[model samples]
Target: MPSPLPSRASAAGPVPGRYDRFLILGAVCLAGLVLPLSFTAPPVAIPAIAAELGGSPVALNWMTNAFMLAFGSCLMAAGTLADTYGRKRVFSIGIVAYAIVSLLLALAPSLAVLNGLRIAQGVAAALALAGGNAALSQEFHGPARIRAFSLLGTAFGLGLAFGPSLAGWLVQTQGWRSVFLSSLAIALLATVFGVPRMRESRDPDAAGLDWRGSLSSTAMLALLTIGVLEAPERGWSDGWVIAALIGSAALLALFVRVETRAARPMLDLSLLKYPRFVGAQLLPIGTGFCYLALIIVLPVRLIGIHGLSALNAGLMMIALSAPMLVVPFLAAVLSHRIAAGTLCAAALLLAAAGLVWLGVEAAAGSVHGLIAPMLLIGAGSAVPWGLMDGLAISVVPKERAGMAAGVFGASRVSGEGIALAITAAALAGLLQLRLSSAIGVDGATLTQAAQRLATGDAARAQALLPQLDAAALVHSYDAAFAWLMYGLAGLTAAIAGVVFALLGDASAHEPAALAEPARDDRIELADEPAC
Candidate 1:
C-alpha cells in the first residue's frame, strides 16, 4: 500500500504545512492502546493494589470506576478543548500529564490517593488519545484515513489480547505497581512522536468554549453511569441510587436545553438531524448492548451455573473473544463490494442472531450447548467492530475530528457500560421476582431460600425450603437469563433496520457531508459532534 503520509506538505497546501500523517497515526495507535490495557490489566492487579494500600471492596471498585467515570464523561469536553486550543498543543501537554499522573498512580501511598490519581490519569488519557485521533482525521483522507483507523483498531485489540496475561506476569514478577509504572512508556512514545509531527489545526471561526454544556454533559453522563454501576451492588431502589437516576435524567434534559441556546455549545446540536450520522452513532450502541452483554454474562454462567473449571470457562470465552478480535480485520476486504450501511446492518443482524442462539443454549441448561453459540457470537461481534468508529466520525468535517473521536469513544464506553448495567438490573429484577413465585414458601423461609439459591447452594437451598420445587426454580432462573438475551437480540435487530433504512448506498462507504453549517451557527458542539 502507498504511504498515508507525504514526506512533507507543500508550503502552499490548503491545510497549511501539514506534517506526515503516518507519524500522527503512530501516536494515535499508541494512545489507543492505553484504554484496553488500562482497563484489562488493572483488574489482574486489583488484589496486589489492594493488599499494599489496605483497600476496602468499595475503594477497590472505585479504583477502577474512578478512571472510567472521568475518562468517559470528560471525553467530549476534552475534544472540544483540543479543537479550540489546538490539537497539537493539547495532545502534547496531555501526553506529559498522562506520564506524570500514571507515575503518581503507581506510587500512591493510600487508596484515596490511588483513586484520585486514577481519575487524573483518565482525564489526561482522554486528551492524548482523542487529540491524536482528531490529528489523524485532520491530516489523512480517503483510503489512508481508513487504514490509519484500522491500525488503531489493531492496537486496541492487541492491548485487550495481551493486557491480562502481561499484567498477571508483571504483578507476579515485580508487583502490582508495575501495571501503572509500565504505562509511562506509552505516554513517552506518544509525546515524542506526536508533539513535533502533529500539525496544529482548530476551528478559527469557532467561538469560546461552552462551559455550561460541558458541565451539564459531564454531570449527566457521570451521574447516569454511577447509578447504573451501583445498581447491582446497592439494589436499584436504594435511596442514593434513586436520587442519582432521577438527577441524571433531569441533567440530561437540561443539557439538551442548554446546548440549544448556547452561543458556543460543546456539542453541536445541528448534526443530529442528519440521518446517516445518527445511524452510524447508533451502530455502537446496538452491537455493544447485544453481544458485549453476552461477553460479561456467559463466563459467569459457565463457571457458576454449568460448573466448569476456570480454564474451561476461559476457553469458552476464547470462542467469543478470538473471533471478535480477528474478524474486524477480515471485514475490511469486503468494503469494495458492500455498502457500508448494508454491511453494518448485516453485522448487527448476525450479532442479534448470535444472542438468540446463546439464549437457546442457555435454555438447554447444559455446558456442552454453549460452544457453537459462543463461536457464533464471536463471529457476529467482529463484523461491526472494524467499522463503527469510522462510521461515527466520517460524516463530519475533518476540523471537527477531535469532537468526533470523543463521540466515538463515548458511544462505545457508554454502550458497554450501560448495557452491562441494564442487563444486570433486568436479570436481577426478574430473577428475584420469578424466584419468589417458583420457590413457593412464606415468611423467612422464602427469603432464606432465595439468598441460598442466588449463591448457587442447591443442597442448602433445598434444606432451607423442602417445599421448594427444584424444577420450577431452575426453570425460573433459565427464563431470566433467556429474557435478557432475547430482549437484547430484538433491540439489535431494530437498530439494524434503522441503519439500513436511514443510510443510502452512496453514503455507505463514503463520508457523507450533506451541507456545511452556516458560519454564524457553528457555535455549539454536540456530545456526538458539531451536530
Candidate 2:
C-alpha cells in the first residue's frame, strides 16, 4: 500500500496576543522543564528511595527506566493523538495528568508502586511534550517560531543541566519525595498558564492512529529492557531471562512487520533504505551511551559508592552536563563553517577520549581528576545533541521530513532508555566477574552483591557478603567501572569510524540541501503524520 500523505492543519485561528504569548510560552516551557527534571533527578534519589522503601538493584534501575521507556515508547502515539484530537485539549489533559501523577509519586509507598506511577508519569510527559510542541508550531511564525523552539530547547537544557543538583539538594534537605513535589508544582503552573491562553488546533485530515505499529514497538522496547535489566540478577542462561530476550526479539520482528504493513506507519521503515539516514540515527545512540547513560550512572557511583552527600554529587554532575547550555549554540554556529558530519564524528571522538581519561582518573580514585574529563564529555556530546535533529530530516526528502523527525526523536529517547538498561547490566556483569574471581562467590549471592555494589548500595552488598570488606568492594567497583569506561570508549570510537564512512563526502553537499530550510523557516514544513 502507498503511504498516506502527512496531514496539514487548516489556517490557525486567531493568534495569541502579546500577553497570551507569554502565557503560552510559559506553560510549554514549564512543561519542557518538567520532562528532563522528572527523568534526570531520580537517579540521585535511588539510594535514598531504596533505603526507605527497600528494593533490588533491578527495581531501583526501573525507577528511571520505567519512566524513560514509557515516555519514549508512547511519544509517537501521543503526537498522533494531539493531531487527531486538538493540540490545546491534549496539552491541557497531559499537564493535568502530570500534576496528578507527580502528586501520587510523591506519596509512593513502595518501589512497585513508584515504578507503576513512573509509567503513568512517562505517558503524561509524552502527552505534554507532543501537544506542547504541536501547539507551538501552530501559534508561532518565522523568527518567532524559531525563537519559540529555541526557548523550548533552553528550558529542556536547563532542566538537564541543573536537575541533578536541584534533586540532590531536595533529597538532602527535604527528602526524595520533594523531587516529585517540585514536578507537581511545575505541572500545575503549566496548566494555569498554558491551558487558559492556548488556542486549539488540529489537522483536518489526520489519519487514524497506527495501533499495531505503536503497540508492537512499545512492547519490543519494554521486553528488551526487562530482559537486559534482569540478566545481571538472574544469569543470562536462566529460563525466564531467555524467554524475555526471545520475546523481545519476536516483538522486534512483529514491529517491523506491522510498520511495513500499516497504511500510516508510526515510523517509515523505508527511511532505513538510505545509508546516510541510518548513520544519522546512530548519532543519537552514540550519545545515549556515551553521555546520557552517565547522567544516571555517575550519580549512583558518586552518592551511593563514593559516599558523597547528595548535594555534592549533584554539583559534580554539573561538570558533566553544564556545557549543554552553551555548546549547542556554539555548534549551531560552527555547523556553517565545518561539515556537519565531520563535526559530529569529531565530537564522538572527543567523548571517547574523555571516557578513557575518566576511566584512568576514576580507577586511581582521584575525585578532582574527574572534573576536566567530565567537562570534555559534556561539551563533546552537546555538539551532536544540537545538530542530529536537523541532520535527520535534512538527509531525507522534504516530503518525508515529518516522518524522519518523528523517527529520529523516537530513536533519540528510546535509544537512551535502552542504553541505560544495557549499561547498568554491563556494569553489574563486569562487577560480578571480579567478585567471583576474587571471592569465589556465585549464583544469587554473587549476582546480589554485584547488583547492589554496581548501583551504589555498598552497605547492603557488604551485609549480603559478610566475608567482603568495604575496601574490597570499592576496589572491585573501580575495576568494573574502569572496564565499563574502556568498553564504552572502544564502542564510541568504532561508531565514529562507521558514521564517518557512511556519511563520507555528503558534508560537501549538505549546505546547499540545508540552506533553503535554514533560511526560510528553520524547520520542517509538513504537518506531522499520525503514528
- Candidate with top TM-score is 1
Candidate 1, 166-273: lDDT as tens digits: 787889899998898888888788777756665566655558677898899888878877887887767777999899989999998999999999886777778788
Q: After superposition, how far is residue 493 of candidate 1 from its true place, in Å?
A: 1.6
Off by over 4 Å in 1: 1-20, 157-162, 442-479, 504-509, 517-531
lDDT of 2 at 180: 96
List the global CA lDDT of all models: 0.71, 0.75
RMSD per candidate (Å) reads: 5.6, 5.4
List ranges where model 2 is wrong by over 4 Å: 1-10, 14-27, 43-65, 86-89, 107-115, 134-154, 157-161, 175-177, 192-205, 390-406, 435-448, 459-473, 501-531
Per-model TM values vs. the true structure: 0.85, 0.80
Instruction: Tell me the lDDT of model 2 at 120.
Output: 94
Residue 510 miss distance in model 1 (angstroms): 4.0
Residue 511 in model 1: shift from native, Å?
3.1
Global lDDT of model 1: 0.71
